[model samples]
Structure formats: structure tokens, C-alpha cells
Target: MNALVPLPVLLPLCATGLSLAFGTRLKQFQRFISVAVLTAVLGLSVALMIAADMNGPLSVHLGDFAPPLGITLVADRLSGLMLTVSSAVTLCVLVYSLGQGMADRDEETPVAVFHPAYLILVAGVSCTFLAGDLVNLYVGFEIMLVASFVLLTLGGTGPRIRAGSTYVIISLFSSMLFLTAIAMTYAATGTANFAQLAGRLAELPLGVQTLIQGMLLTVFAIKAAVFPLAAWLPDSYPTAPAPVTAVFAGLLTKVGVYCMLRTETLLFPGNRLGDLLMAAALASMVVGILGAVAQTDLKRLLSFTLISHIGYMVFGIGLATREAYGGAIVYVVHHITVQTTLFLVAGLIERRGGTTELTRLGGIAKAAPVLAVLFFVPAMNLAGIPPLSGFIGKLGLMRAGVADGSVWAWILVIGSTATSLLTLYVMAKVWNLAFWRAAPPGQAADGTVLESDDDSDDDTDEGPDRMPGTGDEGVRPRHEPAGRAVAATLHGHAVTTTTRLPRLMTWATAATVALGLAYTVFAGPLTAYTDRSAAELIARVPYVEAVLGR
Candidate 1:
């Protein structure tokens, strides 16, 4: 049972090795193995959560070495909860990828690259959550860095390579800053052990403590895509495969947020960066959403909103109250599932209409009501509509801010409300243009109609459930192009529907959406868990004691 803490990290790494050794021949086996590994991890995560909540922090020292000497993996209430949610999210994304036939033999992306890299990404995320020291956290980040870079540039396509380059440069820059911060932390405290730092850091001069805090937070802020540093994300994420984009949007940035939350609560408890965090939170909310409102591409818009909602989590951290932290925790959990589903749905929208551009897409509701419904539920939840998890999370933060009753808190209260309204506007804009409005001329009028080559930024064509408008019975050639031949062939004999959005992909997306709804259905229990987790994280004593065995 104590071993479950490290299994999440180990399972994925082991899977990565096996997938690589299989060398693409056992594609089906690799797929099933990956799924089974993640399922086990999820079950173990749930068990860890139960044990952590009951037994306090559970620590497993590597090679029987103690903290500050050997590496340690700790599963406290907060880490365990994060592990469970992230595992479930990653598992769904893996299934979604399989549904897309990504693992099939493809010239562009070798099976060797995709499956193993994906499993490595999972291990990296798990490593970050369970890390017990600063150096271990850095290692986790590096694992993620390597895996994500490969995943981002998989096809060597133009936009993907461009996005991948920018992602690499920025990630390298952040890694350097993080390394520098770790050096300073070790130089100052003589230890990288998180438990030991809690006491040692408190005794440092206020100026030194503040400097270290600033440096560490800066690195994490960049990683989290928290405004100013967030510019790379909107472009970088939208260029990848749909499943890749979905997992990136959902998990990677939140790891950064998770780090920030931990450092603020544990190491630098009263060191005073609250005001700065509050200012950053407000700017992120306003700036990110405004950017979203101006976006034409569906993926890009969701990327900007991802930045906007991050402000809510930062808001809670800045307030540093138990209720506020609780609210932020709930919000983080809500956003991960919601944001991932939105991206996955964006993939489906493109597959259905052959484009995610608002200008090109229309009549989705009339043609594929199922896809429309999939998009609608999450869109409203993201907009903070009443009775959803998003609304519940926002209400929690607003109440916390109101209770704090400071000038900044009041400003944040108003700001949060405004951000929520703007989020609604953005979601409504997507719905209006992509689903409600008619398709523009020279474009696909209905989901079944053929999309022009211009519709895809990458020149990829997707099969919709319906066919081109010229057919007598709503049928058209599966791979028809927008050329003289296609023009000449219009109004010919009816063709069979060629739907490319696979059943596994749709079912995977639906499962994730259901998980998002699960949050709302079990809101009370989830809220209670967050509340307790927040309080325990703030306490910090149990963590230190568990590590030191005192």
C-alpha cells in the first residue's frame, strides 16, 4: 500500500520502455498495455488518496535512503488527489489517441515515437506531483520537457515545427531559471529536502527569503503560462494533434500551478508576495480572455481561455486563506477536465466540418447534433453557468474574497465576476459562429458537405457524417477536393457516408465529458475533499514529520 505512492511514476516509465522495445510491430499489444497500466495507476491513486487522507503523508524513500540523502516520494492528501485526477485525464487522452488511430503505421509519425513518448509524458507528470525535493521536481520537469518536445513536433509539419521550436526555446529558458533558483536555494539552506527547507527557509533573512521565493515563483509562473510568460502557449498548443493538444492543455500547465501552490503554502508561508500574485491574477483574467475574444481559430481561443482561468487559481494562492485555497483546488480540478474536453471536442469539430475556424464551420447542430451537444455542455460549464462545477468553484472563490474584505479582495471579486462574464461571451461566440450560424459561401454549408483545402491550416481533410450539398441524398466523395474535378463531379451519383471520427475517439471524449459532469454530481464530496486537503497542506507539520520519521 505504501508502495502505491511510487507506482504511478514507475508504471508509465516501464510502459515506455516496453513500447519502445516492441518497435511498432505489437501496436495492438502496446495500446492495450498502455490502457491497462493507466487503469491500474488510477486504482492505486484512489487507494493512495484514501490512505493519505486517513494516515497523513505517506513517504517512500528510494533504496532505503532517508530524505536529504536519497530521493523520496510522498503522497499526502493534496498529491494523492492531484495524482488521481491527472491519471484519469491522461488515461482518457490515451484512449482518445488510440481512437484516432495514431498508433497505426504512419510514415509521418513512427509508432515508436508516439506511444513511448506519451507514456513518458505520463511518467513525467506523475513524477512532478509526487516529488519530495526541489531536485526531484526539476528532474520531473526535464522528463516532461523532453517528452513534450518530441510529441509537439511529431509530424515535422510546418506549423508544428514552428510551434515546437518556440516551445523548446521558452522551455529551455524556464529550465535555466529553475536550475538557478535551485542553486540559490541549496546555497542558502544547505538542503534540497522539502521537509528540511520548511524550517531552514523560515530563518533566512526576509530579503533572502523573498528573493528565493521570487525566483522560484517566476520559473513556475512561466511554466504555468501565467500571463506575460503565457504568450507561447496560445500558438504552441494549437498546432499539435487533437489528443496531444488536449492533454497538454489539461495537464502540463497545471503542474506549474501545482508547484506554485505548494511553494506558497509550504516553504514561504508568510514571506509576502501576495500583493504581486493578486495583481498578476487580475491581469491574467482580463488580458487572456480579451485575447480569446479576438481569436478566429477554435484551438487558439481555448488556449487563451486556459490562461484566463489560471488567474482564478492564482487568485486563491494570493489570498492564501483556507477557503480561498480550497476554492482554487476545486477550480483547478474543474478546469483540467473541462479544458481537455473542449480541446477534444474542437478536434471533433474539425473532423466533422474539416476545420475549427469559426468562419468555415456552420450547421454542426443541424447535421451532427451529437457533436453539438458534446461541445455545448462543456462550453456552458466553462462559462460558469449555474449548477455546474465551474460556477460552484467561482462562487467559492468569490465568497472567500468577500470574506477577506480587503480592497484587493474586493477588486478581485469584481474582477472574477467580470472574467466569468467574458468567458461566457467567448463561449457564446464559439457556439454562435461554429454551430448556430450558416456556413459562409465557398465553404461547407452543412457538416456533411466537403470542406475546401483552404479550410485546413495543415491541408488535412476530415470526413463528416454527411456529404457535399450537391448530392441528391446528402452524399459526396470521401476525399473530394475543391478543384475543377470536384466542381465537375458535383450532382453525380450518391456516395456512401465516410465518417472518420472513430467510435473509440467519440466514446473517449464522451467519457471525459461524463467525468466533468461527475464533478458537478459529486460536488459536495469533492468540495469537502478540497477543503480538507487545503487545510492539511497549509498545516505543513505532518509532511515534515513524515519525511523525518520523528
Candidate 2:
């Protein structure tokens, strides 16, 4: 089982080279390589999860070198669980992207580049989960970010390039901070390995420990998009292609949260900054949802909610107890599935309705009932409706908060509850506007715009000079009328709206939706697993021994 630790990281990387070698010359084979590799990874991850749960942590030393010198990978129960969930989500999203490429005549995803980039992204994510030292973790992040930049600017369209630029800048800044943190850690403690840091950091002076912890937390916080640092997300995500946005939303920020969970528990056992974490959680919950409430675009709306719900996991972490950690882990798993499913469904809605702008969408319930159901289940799940996995996770966290009985905990309980209500309201608004309301005038019941209304341009927020569909970078003619602008927009919408929702895409989304429901069905055993994982993480002994053989 120890040998299995490196396979998840290695398989995708090897497959990546094969994918690139095939390139556009063998598109089908490239797609096959990606799907098969991810499928293998998912299987391996599940096996690792069970093995780690039953047998403690699993560790592998590359080049036969021991820890503190050679690179090491460890898969404890928490990392194993994350690996399983992330691999499953990535595989589903890959299938969805393939379907998208086929539907678009290979225009959207560009199979050649997308396959290798996505494989690299998957390998990077797996590496981070399995990394035993700070330096390996940094390498993993760099690999992931580089691939993400490629994915984000796939078409080289003006909007995508702009959004990708913002994303790249923020990501690079965070990477610099991460490097500084690693350097400081090694300088102070003589080793950057987690197990070594566990014993050594505790011996440092109080001020030095505080400075290092604060710096590391800042770096992870920026990656995680906690409030005050999250302004880049909504702007960066909505412009990408659907599958790119979906996978990023599902896995990336959670990587940051995972790092926080690992470091806080293993390296800073006492939670010296518990109150500070709680305060950030409170602000994230409140500010993030408020931003969501103001969004009219579906993707941007989901982006804000993503930041808001992250607060729930952080809330659990701030409590710093076994039960709290268990709850946080459960919420992380649930959020990853539900959030990815919602974004995929959002893509479907965009395909059917022609745009993500709610004002222009309507009657989807009547036009395409299956899409409606697909959107509704996950949307409700996201809102924490009863009996769903979302509710189960939130309830666990709240219960843990109450048990803590601290004043900050009480405040978080109130804040989280309010955030849940706001989330429900936001989902409901989207449903009413996009799925339930009568189709806009000149738009048919099927969501096709038969003719452009002269006044339609007035309803939109885009200015005449910045018409929505004009991809050219230059300014529009000064004399262009608003009605003419509206006509051009209709033409652009027709191209997307007329596309038949491909069978493969629909099936992939349904598969993801089913995965979210599976969590609800298996809540008991899942919570039990997370509880045990939390115990091991808090104890930190199993992982240390597994890596150092001490």
C-alpha cells in the first residue's frame, strides 16, 4: 500500500506526455488517454482511502532517500479522502469537457492542448495532497497554476485573456508568498518536512513561531479566497470555458483549505490563532454572500457563493476539536461535489438559454425539463435543503459550534445560519428568473430569440460601445444604434442556443449529480470515516511515524 502513494501523481504525469505526443494528430486517442488515466487515478484513490483508513498512513520515499533529504509522499486518511473526492470530480469534469468539445466541433476545449493541460492539473492536485514537505507542496501549486493559466485562456478571446491575466497575477503573487514562507520555515527550523516541523517548530521562540504561522496562513488565505482577498475570483472565473471554470471551482481553492487544515493541525497543534480564524470565517460568510446577492450572471453568482461556503469549512477548523475537524472534512467533500455539479448545470443552462444573464433566460422548466431538474437538485443541495448532503454537513458544523460554547462560536453559528438562508434565497431567485418566469418578449418558449426587440438593449447593462458578443478588441463604431447592437447580440445567442445538448454531456452531469446524492445516502459511514481521520490528524503521530519510520 505504501508503494501506491506515488502512483496517483506519477500516472497522470506520464499520461500527460503521451497526450502531448499524440496532440492534434490523434484527438480521439488523446481523449482516451485522459479519460483512462483519470479513471485509473480514481480507482487508485479509493483503494488508498480504504487502505489508509484501515492501516494508518501510507508513505513513499522517492529515489530510496529518507525524509529531510529526499522527496516524500504520505497519504493519511484525510489526504486519502481528498484524493478520492478530487479524482472522482476531475474524471467527471473531463468527460463533460470532451462532450463539450465534440458538440462544438472541437472549438471550445481544443482537444490537443486541453488533454495534456488537464492531465498536468490533475497530477499537480494529487501531488499537493500527497506531499510530505513544504517544498513539494510549493512545486505542486506551481504545476497546477501553470496548467490553469493555459486552460483559462483557451480560446485567446479578449475577455478570456483579460480574466486569465488577473488570475495569473494573483496566483504568482501567492506563489511568491508561499516561497517566502517555505524559506522562513527552513531557516528557523532546519527542515521543511511536516513531521520534523511538528517537533522543531514548537521549540522556537513564541514570536518566531507566530510570525511563521501568520505568514503561512496569509499565503493559504489568498489561495483560498477568503474575504478581503477574494475580489479576483468572480472576475477571473466567469470568463473561462465551462469545464475549465467547473474544475477550477471544484478543486483549486479547496487545495488551499486542505493546506490550512494540514498545517494548523500538524505543525501548530494548539491553534494559537483560533480567534483570528474565527473572525475571518465570520467575515467570509457575511461579505461573500452579500456579493453573491448582487450578481446577475449565473457563473459570477456561483463564484461568490463558493467563497461564502468556504467559511463553513473554516468555521469548523477554527473550533479546533476532533468533531469540528470531522465536520469540516465532511463539508469539504460535500461542497466539492455539489459546487462542481452546479457549475456543470450552469453550463447546460447557458447552452439552452443562450446566456448566463438571468434577465435574458426564462421558461427553461417548460422548454427543457431535464435541465431544470439537473439544476434544481444541486442548487437546492447547495442551499442546504433538508435531507441533502449540504444540510448534513452544515448541521454537523453548527452542532460542533454549539458544543464549543465560546462567544465567537456563537456568533459564527448565527452568521452561518444567515448565510445559509441567503444562499437559499439566491438560488431561488435564479430558479425563478432562469427556469420559471415567462420567456422575455421576442424570445420563444423554447428560449430562442425569434426577433430582436429594439428596446431589448435597454434591459441589459452593457453599453452601446461594449456590446456583449463582439469579440474584437477595438471599440465599436460611434454611430452604431442600440437596436442594431441588440440584433447582433441575438445572432450571437442563436449560435449557442440552437446547439443540441449532447447526450454525453448530459450523462456526465447526471453522473456528478448522482455523486452528490451518494453522500446523502452514505452519510453515516462517511461521517464515521471523517471522524477517525480527524482524530489521526489532530494526534499527528501516525503521519509522522509513517514518514520517518520512528
Candidate 3:
């Protein structure tokens, strides 16, 4: 009878259907509807969290059919907490995108269509978090993949199209692998319900159980962008528009990590795979940060850092103790907020400076002092500065690692520290290049070239500058006609250019910065909640009982 409670999932689903039906002709209406739907969903998710906290775990079967025969949406402490955080993040990103005028950019003009796809993506994520069965989780994954495919390609640029292709291919392959894993799980246990599988899986032969665990890990690793399968992430993430990049960075990969945490902790506990996971995690941290240091583009550098930080969470998972898992949970929440804020600030820098390429930009702090602070806080936080949420999270994780006392755990601890230092270096590189260097001669106030001038002799070369007339002329400059300059000066005067954040965009950046600060100040309460959620997840029995009515 619990099936009656469907609005939390259904609200977003209905919004998606509405947008698809009337998105183009009534663009404003679509935006209004999308925001309204998501706001309601956010409230519902919060209520769900409060309810779960009050009442242990809650489950609602679909179609009035019992689990093992039908689908179910289960909300325990972990899923409930995840849903609340994810909904809040998505809502903020949606508002930020609107404020940034993303919907109006020619590239995202069809972003009228984006409302529908975005809602569907949120729905999919919710479903994934709430799913009680492996098959249902697979369906949730497919839903998100399909929606993300459209979001990734929204701008229709050559790079976006190319990136979209890679994203889709990787996603589809992962889905197929997930499906295969689900088939194996069902075959082994005769039921896809998570609780049922957990009980049955524990009784299976050790060899068969390991095989199942390997398959599931492979599928989730691809999703989480863990080492050796993480190439698709940096290439694909940087190509999207800012808000989309923010949400994708904030929420998507973490879903994979969530799946991994649940699988290892619940369905296949006591497997002694901690050493293998620790090795993979160490590689992810070192390699990802190294890649970050080598990147000159702001977005690309952040993408590398994102992959690197995923290692810290995985490291916590590998430790497999209550304290370690608690740290991992806190890190997950902290990373989501901090990462999204960083990306959004980077977008603001791009909009104000006219490019994200470090070589082409300089001295933006003079023009956008507020923007400088906005970028600096989270950059430092991501680098694990004291008093910030990032440092608190890393400290928690390192403490847990030391407590575990395994050699591999110690290796992870050292690697994570090194990764944090490298992260600071990369962030500093961006700060110095983008906000500290003097503006180049003949550059506009925002460090952009005001006009193309073949003969100015004032184009300050920063990184790899391209010289004009490199063909047969061979380093010789071609003379511009005297008359051309006079005519161009007259025509160019009418074009007005400015370099400051719009009021709305300024507020959007401020809001995200505020979010980071809030996380920092409220770390104690948040960590306490995360610890409770971790405990519930490890216990597993209440989650099972709620879903199966046993």
C-alpha cells in the first residue's frame, strides 16, 4: 500500500513530459514550469530526509506489487541524505544557469529543450538513489545517460558534438556492462531486489561471489571515472556549457561512487578487496593530480582535479571501517558542493575575460575583484586549506586511514596528501596566470584583444602565440593599406564593449560562494548526519526490512 507515495519521483517525471510537449513555443513558460517542479521536488526530498531520520527507512512498492515481483523505491539514511543534497545542488545550478543567460545563448537557445532533459536527468538520479533492485537501478542509469547525452550536445558546436559522441559511447558501453552484471546477479540469486540479493549472495560460493563483485565494480568504476577507465571524463566535461558542467561535475560521477559504496558495504561485505581498491585509488589520486598540473586551460585543469579527488573518496571506501566510511560520506558531500562552486566561478571568469585559456588572459582581479574572491575561496578549499570544508574532510579521511593501520592504507594516506599539495599548485597556477599577471599591451580592460591589428607591434605573446603571414612571406610582415585603418576606426567606434558581471550573474556567483562557506561553518552538524547515514548503510538490515516488508 506504500505505493501511494509517488509524488517525489513523479513530479520531475511530469515536468519532463510537460516540457517536451510545450517547450519551444512557450520558452518562458517552460522555464517557469521547470523551476517550479524542481522546487517542489526539493521540498519533497527534504521532507523525505526528515521522515527517514524520524522513522528509520521507508519503502514504497510500485503498482501495489511486492518486491521480487515488482519495483520499489527505498529511502534509508544514505539515499535520503543523497537525495536531499543532490536536489539542492541541482536546484542551485538551475538557477545559476538561468541567471548566466545560458538559456539565451545561441548555442543553448534550444535550451528551451534543456528544461525537459534536465528534469529527466534529475528524475533519473533520484530513481537511481532510491532504487531497491538491481534492474531498477539499471533503468535509472539508462534514463540519466539518455538525458545527459542531450545535455552534453546542447550547444551543437563541433567540439561539443565530438565530446558528446565519446560521452555517449562510454555511457552505452557501461550500461551494457551493468546489464550483463545484473543478469549474472539475477541468475545467481534468483532475485534482483537488493536485500534479497544481499542475503543470497552471502551464501553463494566465494569464487562465484567474487566474480559478481568484479563485474559490478568494473561497471561502477567506468561510471565514477576511476583510474584506467577515466579518460572520457576530462575530454567530455570541459566541452559543456558552464551550468551543465557544474551539475555534471557536482552530481553525476558521485552517483557511480554511491553505487560502489553501497555494493561493497552491503551486498558483498567482508570480501577483502580493500587492497585492490586502495591500489586503484592511489593511482587515481597521483595520476589525476599530475594531469591537472599539466593542463593550462582552467576548465580542463578543474576536470583533472575532479578525477583526482574521486580517489580520496575511494580511499575511504577501501579502508572499510565505520570511521573510514564516515569520512568518505562527508568527503562525498563536501566534494559535490565545492566542485560545483569552483566550476561555476570558472565560468564567470570565462565570461568576464572572454576565454578560459590561461595564455590568452591576465589581470582580471583589477576589473572583477569580487570574482577574484569568489574563485579564490573554493580553489583554496579544494586545495585543502585549514578552516575550509575541504581540509576538514581530508583530515577525517586521513585519520581513518591511520586508524586502519594497513600498509596499503598508509600508502593511500601519503598519496592523498601529495595530491592535495599538487592540487594547490594547479590552483595557484590558474590564480597567477588569470588574475595576477599584468594585462598585456593593446589588450582590453578584460585582457582580451580589442581588435585584430597586423601592424600594431603590441600583441604581447604569452604562451604559444601564432604569427601572422607565416606562409611564403616567412616572418616578413605584410603592410596594411593606410586607408584601411582610417575606415576601420570610424566603423569600430559604434561597437560598445564592457567587461563586468551582469547583476544576475554576480548574484549567482555569490550564492555558490555562500554555499561553500555554509558547508564550512556547518561541518559539525553535517558530519554528524553523514556519520549516522554511514552507520545505517553498514547495518543494512533496516534497509532490507523496509523494502521487503519482512
Candidate 4:
């Protein structure tokens, strides 16, 4: 089983090479390889999860070389769980993208390079989860960075280019900080291995330890989009193609949070910066949701909510108790699936409504009852509706907070409740405007304006403005009057657009929605698992002794 530790990282990477070699020449084969690889990875991840739980942490030194000089990967409960969830989510996204490609005739993701880049992204995510040292973790991030840039700019459209540039710059800055921190760690302790550092870092002076901790936390915070560092995300994410956006929103920030969880428990115990973490959590929850409340576009609104919910996880970490950590773990898993499902639903909404603007969308419930159900279920779950995993996770965290009985914990408890309510308000607003309201008289079911009844060539020069970060920077007024535009275009000329939802895309999204509900069905065992995972993380000895073979 220990020998299997590196396969999750290696499999996708090996498949990536094959994917690229096949390239545009073999599209079907490329799709097959991508799906098959991720599916295998997901299965392996589940196996690893069970094995790690039953047998303690699993570690394998690459090429039979010991840790200080060779690459090492460890799959403990945390990593195994993360690996499983991420693999499942990425696999679903890949299927969705394939359906999208077929539906759009490959125009949306025009390049065949998408498969290779996506596989690379999967490998990178797996690598981070299993990384045994700071340097290896840094490598994982870089791998993701390269692949993400390609995916973000897939179409090379203006908005995508601009958004991709911003994403790349922020990622680069964070990477540099991460690398610098790694160097500093190696300089301070002569080894970059996590298990070795756990013992050695304890011997350092209090100030040095604090400084290093601050550096690492800052790097991860930026990656995790915590409070002040999160401003780039809303602008960066909404511009990409829907599938790209879905996977990214689900996985990337959580990787950062996972790092924070691991280091906080194993390397920097006692929660030296717990107060600061709590403050960030408060600001992230309040500020991020307020941003969500102000958005009129569905995707941007979801992006802001993503930042806000991240605070819940951060709050759990700041509490630094077993229950809090467990709650955080559960929330992380819930958010990854729920958030991804919402974005995919957003794609379906866009497909049916022709745009994501709340002002223009109406009567989706009447037009496509299925799409409305897809959107509503995940939207409500996101708002922490009872009996859903979202509520279960938040309730646990709040309980942990109250149990702590600290003033800050109490404040975060209030903040968490408030955030949940605001999230509900935002989702309800979307529901009211995008689904319940009646469609305009001249508009088609898909939001396109139809021909005027009267034969008037007169144009009203009225239309919706383009969303920021979605290209078309300058607003182009509609040449037709309110009831006269056709195909929902910026210009007077009409262009053909697909009105029917793709079956494959819809079914893929339904699969994700089902996965989210599965959490609710098995909430008992899931929370139990997270609780045990949290305990293992806090103990720290299991990981250290397993890695060092002591």
C-alpha cells in the first residue's frame, strides 16, 4: 500500500504525456485517456483513504532513496480524503467539458490542448496533497500554475487573456514568496522534509519560529484567498470558460487551506497566530458576502460567495480544536462539491438564458424546470439549508466555537450565522430574478428578443452592458428597441445560438448534484471520518513516526 503513495501523482502525469502526444490528431482517444486516468485516480484515492485510516500514514521514498535527499510522498487521512474529493470533482468537470466541446462543436475550448493541460492540473493537485516536504509542495503549485494559465486563456479571447494575466501575476507573486520561504526553511534547518522539520523547528527560537510561521501562513493565505489577498479571485475566475471556472473554484483555494491545516496541526502547534487567523476569518466572511450581495451577474456573485464561505473553513482552523478541525474538514469537502455544482449550474443557466445577468434573466422555472431544480438544490445547500451537508458543517463549527467560550470564537460564531443568512439572501435574490419572474413579452424562452410585431425599422439603441472581465470592454448598445432585438446580440445583426441544453452536460451536472446530496445521506459516517482525521492531524505523532520510520 505504501508503494501506491506516489501513483496518484504519477498516473495523471504519465497520462498527460500520452494526451499531449495524441494531441489534436486523436480527440476521442484524448478524452478517453483523460476520463479513464481521473477515474482510476479517484478509485485509488478511496483505497488510499481506507488504507491510511486503517494502517496509519503511508509513505514511499522515490527510487528507494531516503527523505532528506530524495522525493517523498505521504498519504495520511487528510491527504487521502483531499485526493479523493478533488479527483471526483475534476473527473466530473472533465466530463462536463467534453459534453460542452461536443455541444459547441469545440468552439468554446477550441484547442485540443485542453486535455493535456487539464491532466497536468490534476497531477499538480494530487502532488500537493501527497507532498512530504516544502520543496515538493512548491513544485506541485508550479505545475498547477503552468496548466492553469493555459486553461484560463484557452480561447485567447480578450477578457480571458486579461483575466489570465491577472491570475498568473498573482500566482507568480505567491510562488515567489513560497519559494523564498522554502529557502529560508532549508537555511534554518538544513532539511526541507516535513517530518524532519516537525522535530527540528521546535528547537528554534520563539521569534524565529514565529517569523517562519508568518511567512508560510502569508503565502498560503494568499493562495487560499483569505481576506485581503482574495480580491484577485472574483475578477480572475468569472471570465474563463465555464468548465475551467468550475474546477478552479472547486479545487485551487482548498489546496491552500489544506496546507494551512497540515502546518497548523503538525509543524506549528499551540496556534501562535490563532487570533490573527480569526480576524481574517471575520473579515473574509463579512466582506466577501457583502460583495456577493452587490453583484448582478450570476458568476461573479458565486465567486464572491466562494470567498465568503472560505471564512467558515478559516474559522474552524483558527479555533484549533479537534471539533473545529473536523468541522473545517467537513466544510472543505462540502464546499468543493457544492461550489463546483453551482458553477456548472451557472453554465446551464447561461446556456438556457443566453446570459448570466440577473436583470435580463427571467422565467427559467417556467421555461426549463429541470435547470431551475439543478440551480435551486445546490443554491439552497450553499446557503446552509437544514439536512444538507452545508448546514451540518457550519453547525459543527459553531458548536465548536461555543464550546471554546472565547470572545473571538463567540464573535466568529455570530459572524458565521450572519454569513449563512446573507448567503441565503443572495441565493434567493438570484432565484427571484432569474427564475420566478415572467419573461418579457418579446423575449424568447432562452432570453433572446424576438422580431417586433409592427414593421418598424426604428432601432431603440438599448441593451444590457457586457460584464467586466468577460471581454467586450466597451459597452455596445442594442440597435433594436426593448422588444425588437434577436439572438441577444450587441449589434443589430442577429447570430444563431443554441437554445437546447446538451444532454451530456445536463447529466454530468446532475451527477455532481447527486454527489453533493450523498454527503447528506451519509453525513453520519462522513462526520465520523472527519472527526477521526482531525484527531490524527492533531496528534501529529502518527505522521512523524510514519514518515521517519522511527
Q: Model 4: per-residue lDDT, tens digit, 5-24? A: 89898999999899888766
- Using lDDT as the yardstick, the better of models 3 and 4 is 4
Q: What lDDT score is found at residue 95 in candidate 1?
A: 89
Judged by lDDT relative to the true structure, which candidate is superior, 1 or 4? 4
Candidate 4 colliding pairs: none
Q: TM-score of predicted model 2?
A: 0.91
Q: Which portions of model 3 miss their true places by more than 4 Å?
A: 1-5, 102-109, 441-498
**Per-residue lDDT of 366 in model 3:** 72
- Which consecutive 10 residues in model 2 have the weakest lDDT in total? 482-491
Residue-wise C-alpha lDDT for candidate 2, range 317-388, written one tens digit per residue: 899999899999999999999999988888787777666777767778877899999999999999999989
Q: Mind giving the per-residue lDDT tens digits that candidate 1 earns over 275-384?
A: 89999999999999999999988888999999999999999999999999999999999998999999988877776666677876676786678888999999999999
Per-candidate TM-scores read 0.91, 0.91, 0.89, 0.92
Model 3: clashing residue pairs?
none
Clashing pairs in 2: none
Which of the numbered candidates is closest to the native, going by highest lDDT?
A: 4
| 245 Cα displacement, candidate 4 (Å) | 0.4
Which residue runs does candidate 4 get wrong by more than 4 Å? 107-109, 441-497
Q: Root-mean-square deviation of each candidate, in angstroms?
A: 5.3, 6.1, 7.0, 6.0
